[model samples]
Target: MDNLTHSLVGALIGQTGLKRKTGLNIPALIIGANLPDVDAACFFWLEGVEHLGFRRGITHGPPAWLLLPLVLAGMLWGFDRWQAKRGKRPEGRVPVHFGWLYLLGFIACLTHPALDWLNVYGIRLLEPFSSQWFYGDTLFIIDVWLWGLMGFATWWSLRQEKRGETWRKTGRQALALALVYIGVNGAISTYVASSAQAANPQATQVIASPLPVTSWDREVLLKVDYGYWAHVESSARQDLARPNKISVSPCRLSTATAGANSQLDAFLFWSRALIAERAEDGSVILRDARFYDPRARDRFSLALPDVECEPLAPPSP
Candidate 1:
């Protein structure tokens, strides 16, 4: 999820907690919740250092979670002590019930990684030790539904609270809607993925990509069981057009197909099922199709020669 989405969720949780109980340090809690994303700052100031490699490393690892409570506690102590020394009411021990602050921070930061996982670029949540990249391939990196839910919840809660309305009415309703949307989105993604997989049981590696294409209904990423062959493609199946064009791998399947069966047939099946335009070269092209730009093939050539430019031209029509 994006910053605004994270912030809205954090604020909503904060508001709900405050509404239910007394003594939460809402501001500090909210700040701590968003601290993990401080990594985003590196993208601008640190350049290649930020997300280029370290996006979901130690910061998102399981071990880092243990230190959060301690870190929050120490931060709380220091801030209060400073306030007291300055002759002010030291924010008074931050309502003990607010210790749930740890959970708040955890969930908030967790959302960051979870959302990133939805993107094509993988997130190494279990880094160093386990660099195996994992992707949800479910939701889009930033969903408009998430944004609207979080924003509406925060707004509705604040406004209703101002009018002395019940928090349960506005706040809970918003959270419920968000959860429902996530659920529905997840179910649809899973069904599509399962269908792609069943379409080709022999595929060595299957990457189901619903994003990175336009007007294009589905894009499936596949790795065949043959010659280390792979592909990133999109294809079409239309209701009105009988026997419309489709491929085992279609987005860039411009490659001639005489020897198409050379690559593992399994991966090729999914590729053809999902492809629209085969690559000019039969080789797999690993590139982000997010922009759906008509000229993406040309652009991909610049960065991914191995996957994009290698010409394993399909044998023949």
Candidate 2:
């Protein structure tokens, strides 16, 4: 989910009876939502040091979350102590059920990677012990559907509850909707994996994802790069991988243009290093260029805002 969605979720979660304070639970939700990205900090480009996928290491690992509760509890305790000394109570302290509050933070933080894994991108769920990346290729990084379904539902439900409506009713309905989305996408991913296997039973196959765009809608891409030449299945409604894969090895975003052969080269210039790729036939392939994709291409792949193109160099004179 994007920052806005995250903020909204935090706010909604704040409305819980568990959160008696005005601002305490909201901050927890926000922190929990973003806590996973902390791994990005480890990606320090240096003059002497080499490059490494920081998140695929400790940050995305299962064991790394083991300390999440302890860290959160300590922070809350320190805050409570500070408030006592000042004789001015803090605005957002979880007065009761410290254990449950800490637990929620841990789960919120964990959700980041769990959702991240659903996308075609790589994540190291079990790090230190292994560096092999596992990608569910489940959903798009910043899908609007997830925002509306989870964050939006949470907000509306909370709002209704505030006005003496039934929070339980709305929350249950929201949960059911969310589960359906997850289940449908999960089934879709399996179908994609099967399609890849049928393509080359002799080869070892690994399925990537069906990035969620809405409650039950998603964009799925399957990459068969493990064997000889790499191929991709950029399917919408469960299309299979074709033999002829787009061979834009080490491509750049600057190459995106209609009827151009610089397909591979153009994607490289974009934030491929920071996002997922959804390749379509030579026609186009969409990626989550959050830091660079100005139009939020996730909205509509072909709707990306135009950027001035540098002419491909003329043939040698």
Candidate 3:
């Protein structure tokens, strides 16, 4: 999920009466919601596809979940005292309760990874303990519909608060509706994927990637043999349409050469459906079948050693 979605979720959680828990509870919620993304700082030191392997790992795991909120709570507690020392504390501010602040921070931080796991990009939920990647494949990375739904509810809640009426109910209703929407989409993806696999016994895997702005639509990819076959699916349709084969490199990576390159190793670690193709210059190009695009061929690709690439063995049917 995008940062805006994460931030909006945090704010909505805060609007559900949690903001009254402490003087800086709202900030704690908002910042904690995005704290797991601090791993994005890897771009400053790591190059190329290396960040892909590092992101959504340790920082999003259990250890960070437990420690990050504690750190955030302590900072908020210090800030409150600092304000008091300067005689600048807001008169209307509620007393800062370290316990409540920490709870709010923990609640918000937990929402971050939950949202992140709902897309095709995937996340490492048990990172440090196990580097397994989990994918929800239920929603697009950025859903404008979610933005509208949660964004409007948040705004309406704030408006109701200003009017001194019950506002938490509005937030709760919005949260419920959002959950229903997500559940429905998850069901749709599951149905499409299962249907695809059942129809093609030779398929090793099937991915139902949600498309942006169309909750009922999905781009289905079936892994077979040496590559993948893709087609669009709509809930309104009665049957799975014919799928076109995706062009991919038939070259295989040299284990000895790839092991020596950190960049190639990182790319391999993060690529779920890796494909290797021989470039015009004889160098091998590696790409993931999940996100391969001709217009942006180099986006998630890396070049392997210049040695003659080996041919891939035909996959078992």
Residue pairs in collision within model 3: 249-277
Alpha carbon lDDT at 16, candidate 3: 88
* Models ranked on TM-score: 3, 1, 2
TM-score of each: 0.65, 0.64, 0.93
Best of the candidates, TM-score: 3
The candidate that wins on lDDT is: 3
Candidate 1 lDDT, 139-216, residue by residue in tens: 665666677777877887888777888765666677678777666655656665566567656555555555532312
Over the full model, what C-alpha lDDT does candidate 1 score relative to the true structure? 0.51
Candidate 2: where are CA atoms >4 Å away? 1-23, 44-52, 90-97, 199-243, 247-317
- Summarize candidate 2's per-residue lDDT along 140-211 as a digit string, tens digits: 666687667767677777778778886656655665676577677777767766766676554344444444
When summed lDDT is taken over every stretch of 10 residues in candidate 3, the lowest stretch is 229-238
lDDT against the true structure, each candidate: 0.51, 0.51, 0.85
RMSD of each: 8.3, 9.8, 2.2
TM-score, candidate 1, is 0.65
